[model samples]
Target chain A: MVFSRYNSSHSTAPSAPELPPESYHQPQQQQYQSYYGQPSSIYGQSGGFPAGTQPDVVRAFQMVDRDRSGFIDEHELQQALSSGYQRFNLRTIRLLMFLFKNPYDSLRIGPAEFASLWSCLGHWRAIFERFDRDRSGKIDSMELRDALYSLGYAVPPSVFQVLISKYDNGTGKAGLDFDSFVECGMIVKGLTDKFKEKDKEYRGSATLSYDSFLCMVIPFLVSYD
Target chain B: MVFSRYNSSHSTAPSAPELPPESYHQPQQQQYQSYYGQPSSIYGQSGGFPAGTQPDVVRAFQMVDRDRSGFIDEHELQQALSSGYQRFNLRTIRLLMFLFKNPYDSLRIGPAEFASLWSCLGHWRAIFERFDRDRSGKIDSMELRDALYSLGYAVPPSVFQVLISKYDNGTGKAGLDFDSFVECGMIVKGLTDKFKEKDKEYRGSATLSYDSFLCMVIPFLVSYD
Candidate 1:
């Protein structure tokens, strides 16, 4: 069956298309430039962030920056992630840096950028809690699958397993903490948006070859390639 | 302000774009013929309907198609809507007919198409119940607004009012029952998907002109135009 093939391929090998790291870095550089040019333009503009949460976001960023350098570098980020929230692998950290609009590949996060990232992360945390119905601090694979579906992505089981494996600890239990949950949500949201682009005729769904699906989801996955 | 203009315009006049009924009827005819030509191809393929719910959908359609005509016309749909579920207006019924792939402009729904529609509605119902938090047999306008946000639509207040007024009972209270809730969900999902298409660059948001918003959501609105 198609799903079984997807499962076998996923289990045996990593799935995302192999791109040079520079290919990943270029667009993010441009995105950061634009974002820095108009930092406040991103959040609260789209009702994604709550009205007064700007202050909260700034405070959160200040607490993470600690050194008063007005920027949170990779080391600071690592400390923040490891101390209180979920622990993320290096690949996930790199993705977060890119997403948080690290300017000119500086690998550091400034206040405006950090505020935007913080607010978005807050939104994702709320979503995570909603789906983490048992208050277990982690969402099991089943909950994660349902969350994706509710967000309008109906991933195959193998694709789902790959998603779970990306975040699950080595303990053999398939679950995702808040950071993993946020990462997964962002990836799914991006991919689902892309799929909807191809489905413009609104024929009710979009069909993609498995290869295309991997291309869309691969960048967010921890790269073993 | 932009919101004030939207609200005043909506209050003073009907908001959906005007098109000849024939214009609305044409593409749906093609869609229905294509759907009927390949009936089962519609449901499970799209990831819209979950696996293993086909039997439940078939049973639901059978129960609704009381005459055993193997098809459900507007009257049968009306019976189904009014008896066990919530009531909907004529315009809403026409929209549902188009969505359900009514065959050859006959305005009658066949088993396969009905099953597909039923399953999608089941998904929407689960969403509705989750937000219907009070279990009061209706979702108030506030709940409806939050539901849309949770579903990733960041609609403005005026747009939300327009949405509420479409389904709210005449008691001056704004709330939606199951059928109305389903109709609203379908419209929002379609619009949000279209918006995401325009937001492909993922600059975090899509900006649609009022005209474009109307063009996308008009067909589903009760057309007093």
Candidate 2:
């Protein structure tokens, strides 16, 4: 499988800090298991790490905050995530920074935000593994759809086309590497979540006035700005 | 989920020939568990049955082949399937007949074809369950994509639009019930399998001359005629 090809290098990284397989140590596993898991509240409230996962999250932060700074920028966040998990693309790293931006520093994430981000990644990892059924370190269009479906969105084929084009590996191969996969998943997820806030009845459609719609979309548009 | 509304009646049916849960007793369960599971060859040779699953398949055939004419037409096939599984749409039943037409009767399937069809449905059922994560008795566009992914096809979102539109419930519910879901799945699986025959290396692209492409698609176009 393609996963073997990609995971082979990281399997032997000498200094990489390893967290236990998600099933092993996390007591609150079930609480935040889904892609739309409980972390939204946790994220909004700037809560600390879920009880059992703190040590691992803190250790990863300290490793990347090499200068003993209280926060890690995109480069450090990338290093921190890669050492503990798969390497994230710079675009995804920036997206994460934007989502989990520190209150005091717009360019970086602090411990609480970092912890929230890590917890969120754990959920995304679970989702990624579920859809990457071939263990190919990436998901093709079919896998992407399945991932989106599990999250309760019945997107059209056009959605897949746009996502594949956006997240393509650039090798002309139609697959999304881990970083791109998570980014795509989060995009679908984040948007669906936002839409659902308006679709309180779960009717699979929502009505948003112009300003209301812009408020929902502008965050994503300006995130990189 | 919506499944409760759709499945509750069938759950209480008096004559339903309940097959054991897929995990229960079938020895050959693992052999044919995938959407592209081993039944293709089993299907090609007009083989009798996969050894351990014979009884259930035979029983289903006998129950549907009520006249004992060693044959069951579309209506009978639909009845048999709905009893053993969920109700399949007539269009899907027609699609099945087109694919598994009896040697002596173009409008129906015989014992061997019926057995093959049953086995194939078992595999589709497993896939349906996996992607119907919400147990809504239907798969939305997202669920549809996940199902396709498991079968190794990464379709674009536009494919979802086409499929969701094609297989839609007509209730404006942007979802596919079991019958429509199976039809959609089979269409994708059958096409991929056919294409794979030409592209042995699985390069995610295939080259076919004009005649070859026509030969590949003409059957589906002309199947109903």
Candidate 3:
């Protein structure tokens, strides 16, 4: 009776064709539309992430904008240079000042104008090497002072401290060392080296080697009797 | 001997020592005497310039002070920068602003301060390298704009021309490239470098490298666009 009763509905059902072994896994083949879902990816991909080789510019900018204003400015720039970028030169500052004027209210430097700015500052490489005393890839406050003295100038601790303090990362540190300051400059200027070469004339022989020059100059610059 | 015939008495006396052999010429030593005349010239004669190695820091400052104003102000500094030097960073502005703030007409950034000050600006190498794209060791207006643009800011042509006009060396170039601009920066900072692995890190990498990142962030800052 049970079998007879079950046959009433069972006999009415239609039987479909069997799927292949591979088809079991391929059930959703039609549903597999596009690729997506990844973080920090590039443009052009099916995913929201960028597909093509978008420059890591976003990340790089983040690194440069030390103050987190979501933008970079002169002070931020000054701070970045003090922090360690040692290449954000003053020459560009001429243009920097020109792009906009009167700091407090105005702050948007346009791209069109910017796109037409100076491209590099190679002289600083030679300059840095001179002050980088120990050559530890940085110039500490002491080194800075010494380097300045080498250039025939003497600086007071008070004034020196004030300058370093402006760029201080609030480490309660008194002043900037060479490396940290250069790093700050780099971030501010967005620097890049285009070539590598020494001044053959100077390197070969000149009035004096840069090192010897520093030795001679720092003492002369010292204001202390 | 023939040209010296006019100075009959001195020429005939033969008091002058023989010149050194062609193989060994101490140009620096000789030039040293030229700037600060030697009391001695030969081994037996002791009238060559004092072999004092100390640099005349006071003289250096005076030279930079061109107008004999007893101090170097922004205008004087601008003149120097236009001459060729780019180490000065925002600190130069700060220094100028400091001098501007001084109530005394006798305000002067003394040598010590300069030593330390240039040391502070020495960190701006990154900014320089970015603008010195060709790596020829300086920057012009186009290069400056490019560097600024890389920092996410741009300088308008009107302003750029005006800025360059401030220090136009009769070049009529309308703008500065890297070398010229850096020289200007150096003059602003007071010309001050030498020691490190030669900032290879600051060189070229076009695709959103550090320089590009910096450019991207510069648009909104204390000054630059």
TM-score leader: 2
Candidate 1 has what TM-score? Answer: 0.33
TM-score of chain B of 3: 0.30
TM-score per prediction, in order, is 0.33, 0.36, 0.20
Our model 1 lands, by Cα RMSD against the true structure, at 23.0
Q: Which candidate is the best by DockQ?
A: 3
Cα misplacement distance, residue B156 of candidate 2 (Å): 3.4
lDDT of 2 by residue, B1-225 (tens): 211111122222211112232333232322223313343443332234444556666777777666555557888988888867867766577667756665334566665566667877777788888888888888777777777665444545544554454334323345767777667665554454455555544344454432243234333322111
**What is the overall TM-score of model 2 with all chains considered together?**
0.36
Question: DockQ for all models, in order?
Answer: 0.01, 0.01, 0.06
lDDT of 3: 0.33
Assess chain B of each prediction and give its TM-score.
0.54, 0.64, 0.30
Deviation in Å, model 1, residue A49 alpha carbon: 47
